[model samples]
Target chain A: MKPIEARTERGRRAPPLPSPGVRFGEGFLDRLGRLALRVRSRRERREGGGEARLLGGGMEFVGFRPYRPGEDLRRLDWNLFARHRRPFVRVSRRESSERWSVLLDRSASMGTGFPGKLQLAAEVVLGLKAAANIEGAEVDLHLMVRGEPHRHRGRGAALAEWMELLESTEARGRGGLARLLAEPGRFKDARALFLVGDLADLQPADIPRLTRSGRDILLVQVLAPEERDPTRLPEATHGDAVRWADPESTGVRTVRLDAHALAEYERGLGARLEAWRAIAAHHRVSFTTVTSDTPFEAVVERVFAR
Target chain B: MSVPQVAAALALGIEWSRPSGLLLLGPAALLLLLARRSARPVERVTATFDLWEDAMRRIPPAPRTRRLPPLPVVFAAVAITCAALALAGPRIVGSDPPRVFTILCDRSPSTSLPLQPGRTRFEVALEACLSELARRAGSTDRVRWRSQDRETLELPVGVKPPASWFARPAAFLPEIEWEREDRPGFLWVTDRVPTPSPSHALVFASGGRGVPGPVASRGGERVVWREGGLRVEPAPGRVVELRGVEAGRLGPLARLLTIWARERGFELRGGQERERALLIEAGRGAGETRELRIAGGSLGWGLAGTGGAGGIAELPEGAQVWRFGEASGGEAPILVAGSPGRVLLAFDGVRSVEGDPALFALAWSRFLDRWVLPAPGVVPLDERRDAGAASWDEWSEDRFEEVPRVGAGRGETTSADLLAPALAGIGVLFATLAILLSGGGISWLRGRLPASRTRT
Candidate 1:
């Protein structure tokens, strides 16, 4: 499937990506395969399923619990009920038949950074799709472009088709995470939903609403190293003044790089990060920050290993 | 003095000409203040207004102080002062009073004696007079030349003696003016000591050479034969004889004999026909020609013949001759004669005379006065000595101070334009300083402005 063109705040199309193909070299694939194996092992040991907790018929027993009145008799363990003279249900581990839905933010803000947040997020998405395919789960790629969601579904090798489309996508437009995820019908069947973006424009209040749609919501905030600590940016600390331009909105601000102003900026940024952490905790959504400079394998290992 | 009194005195001392330039200072100061408000540095920023506004609200505003801007105020003050000074026409008050000077210059024959080889005492005295006059006498000073107690000539102030005046005959006064009062200081230039005077005066004596003093003699009807000519003493009706040589051969000597005989009232006979009271023989060896050589005669009182070719005489044994004609080997006298009665000529004829006639006449006139003139009861005044001896002790410093100040008229006043270049220079300096100070002050003020964030 072809990726939709991202739009800017002015409703103008952004520049196209440099190339239409993303090459995964043998070494990169080997690293990614090892990371995927680790993720599967860890998930199996912890939950007996791959990144999900869905009920299904399986031979491995999970646990027993008191049977409810309306529960099916087939689930009842008669042998345990005769010994205990109480009705107990037999619970088997669910099969690892899960659907993975990846929501990628194709916003102008993601266009900043060394490897670019969009590029890093695409790599992360590709790694996740590969891991999901390996685990025999169906994967869907949903790209949020210009505040609209476009989805593409595939299984196995077909899941790899979206790599080219993801590579062709340029970072443009503003992504509305909460609004896109609030429509739960499209992603109701998906066991795990991954939202990948810089997340700079997202408000803390939007987190809980976004978490309601997906059974498990993984928020991978793909930020540039400069965005996390602006002082590390080469141009930020040099001159008496620095100008910051927002990629997602028509907003610009210039400030003196004096001690007081730099301290204030750091404080504001810290508060924003803390607020996001609090929101994530409150919503029970898995949250992790990944800098664009991090290696793809490292990100995969860090985000998917549990 | 009190400050206001001093200021008033200064204000009264200066007169102003242009009072309009002071208006510029007001506008300049206002413009400078406005410029300070606008020159603050501006910086561009983005949509962080909410955060920035909050941060700014947290920061307390700086305290306000009531004080003037030092540099600007100083610059303005300097500029205003300079402008005010320039606008006002300034002048100093007062006048220089004029004075009158009177100069009394001595004009005497002895002043002609040479001080140096070429410069006469008269010339030196004249030079000194001119120098003194140029020094102390202004153009309006009065000057008069006095000789023999009379004003020979009056000179305009600052007038130099004519170049020919040095070569001209000496000015002689016939009589003295005794009634004039000496008010202004008198300057006497002479070669002799003058008698004392009661007025304020300064004497400049050129005392290089001494003049001959008056001679005293006791005689009755004496006929003296001195060098150059003969003289008769007390000759009321003297008879003189010229026994040798014809009148035609006598030449200049005949003319001298006629003038002398007329002055002495002598009856002259050409030959020795009557009883001769005196005799003058012109031809060589015609009469007894005594060659008496004088020993150290006074050359100052004698005539020195100039040029070659004139009658020569023999000197007495061991006599020292001052000057003589070439005919006698320049050692003998120019004439040989007796002291009181007889006279003789060494030349064959006076036609051979070729010397200074006036000088020769002066020598003979002096001889006549010594031998023929009667002794008077009183000696004639030596004008140079009288002028030189005139006492200037009365001309003390106090008397000099009393001389009316000449040259400048009374109540004279002058305008001193004190504002042209001096006040203009001060104004320009103040203006330049003001400009520089304003620029620097405005820069500092702009730096002090609050930091701003704006769009690029």
Candidate 2:
């Protein structure tokens, strides 16, 4: 019992990984991308075959298009006939030519890898795009990719175009998760605002505000596996002194991780997790953190489960 | 001691013994009890609160009320009281001196000077003291002595006199002056003047080595005067012999003698030259036939007798002796017999021509009767008397008076005997002063201090 507490204690003070992707190197990132692609394909196959009318799931309607055979006959544009008198079918989906925003956190913390948190984050966005494509949801990309990525939006096939664009972008340094959520353009169509980074950056008070204006928020926290179970194995007994950078500034403070300190960290970490769970539960928002070494498929499963 | 002072002390002691006064002891005990009670609370409170530093500040707390130091003032008042009482002459009653002799010899530094070639003032004074002792040889005696340069006493008047009397000048100097002022007509032994007397015999001595001055007298009668710085000399001459003087004429000498005798322990009777005739009539009461004969002289007297009832008499000069019967010629002895009787004999200062053996025989014969008079199995004096005669004087004419009182007619020097009472009074005074100075002073000082003052 004593050793168990000692191990837990040691894991607690283990400093945060340098970046979520640092735990996973290139090979880990490739594996995560492969897993993400598999989850995306499987989700598409299931949802497209079984749930055909997912376009109605969103809050707003996209514009009407020329009617195609086998399109739902009930989605025909009776209103447009009364206005322009054309035999057009209503798109009856959020898929439109409106701009969409993709805010990627390039903070130094995103580099920590086990299952490659940064790679997984990118894959999450790519998967979201793939899922949206089957439901005919348009996508616009506001990429805060490395420094600050620009926003662009367009229609049906262009949604896949945004996913390809996100995959090619690299994660960089220092920006607020709230700054991305607070942007008016991100909520222009009352679109889903998916934050792909450690939700550690967003304070508790910020959650209510993000939801107050009626924007859909999906928080994905990218954490390393060691962060989840920070226990020390016998081989790592001397102690791990980890130096973490501010990600927003040139400053760095060295944190010493040992059995005693680890215990304190675990206590704090447990408290923080509880606090986040409470906030998310109150706001009826979906929140899930993907740890290092977690299969990307598990993340996909968690996102839908939320 | 004043009886009231003793009673007051006894009353205070009795007050302390009672229950009410015993309750006065409660405060100190209660203080201890309260301290004990508060101790646990203080400790618990101190433990419960994390502020140990604040608790320490509160303990043995700061004075609740300001107070000036009263100890010094109280001590001063006490000292004043003691000084006043001392000045008031506090004293206790003391015992009369036991029958003992104190031959105070002055041996100051002044005693070193000589009046003649070989004799210093010290030697002459010592000789005079020796003569005085010889006059009183057989009585229990103690010698007290001092010198300007040395001191000696076989057994001190109290427990002990100073062993190092020469270490200080105080001891012998006062005695010399005291002797000179009090006891005149003897040698005033000292180095310096206070002048010499013509008729008063004197020997003076001085300290430090030197050739003595010549001894001389301006009067026709010559004597050695001084040697070194000290004067050692006889008086010019005896002015006149005191013999043949009338009863009134020898007043001073008799008084001086009586005092000396009282100090030395001889139950003296009569006045100075005031003849007392105790006429013990022979054959006054009928009982066993007993005879007593007293004989001898002014210088030495012998008492002898043949018969069971016997007595001895001492007669000095111009004193008359009468015989009811014929004088038995063998030693000019007066013989008496009868039941219970006494005789009075008196003599002038005339020597007896009787030889030593006859005198010794007479003395021995008296001792023989005196020895048998009070044998253990014989009827004791009290038992011999009848029941009606409860008092001793009713039964016997020769009952002992425990203390002899003197009348004014005799002018003997009772002054010397006053020394014991004087010394005792001084001791009492000093002891009372010492107690008041030390004990009372301390108590009063303690009382004056403020009760709130805490000594940490």
Each model's fnat?
0.07, 0.00
Question: What's model 2's lDDT at B349?
Answer: 18
B154: Cα error in model 1, Å: 64
lDDT of 2 by residue, B79-127 (tens): 4433333333222222112223333445543454444578654555445
Reference-based TM-score of each model: 0.35, 0.30
Candidate maximizing DockQ: 1
What's model 1's lDDT at B279?
60
Give per-residue CA lDDT, model 1, range B1-456, as digits (tens). Answer: 334534654767543334465565676567556555333212222223334434334444333222244565566666666666565544332222334545555444556545668976666766666676566544545566554433245567776445554442322322323225344556666555454543555555666633333222232344443343345455224456776566665666577777776666565568663433456655533244333222222222222212113333443322222343323454444454433234555544554333456656566555443333223221122422223331222344455545554443433332233334566677777766766577775566566667622221
Q: What DockQ does predicted model 1 obtain?
A: 0.03
Error of 2 at B370 (Å): 99
* Off by more than 4 A, model 1: A1-27, A47-97, A145-147, A156-159, A176-179, A212-214, A235-239, B1-456
Task: Give lDDT per model, in order.
Answer: 0.54, 0.41
Query: In candidate 2, which residue ranges exceed 4 Å CA deviation?
Result: A1-101, A145-149, A154-168, A212-215, A232-236, A250-253, B1-456
Task: Give the CA lDDT, 0 to 100, for residue A228 in model 1.
Answer: 65
**Candidate 2 DockQ vs. native:** 0.01
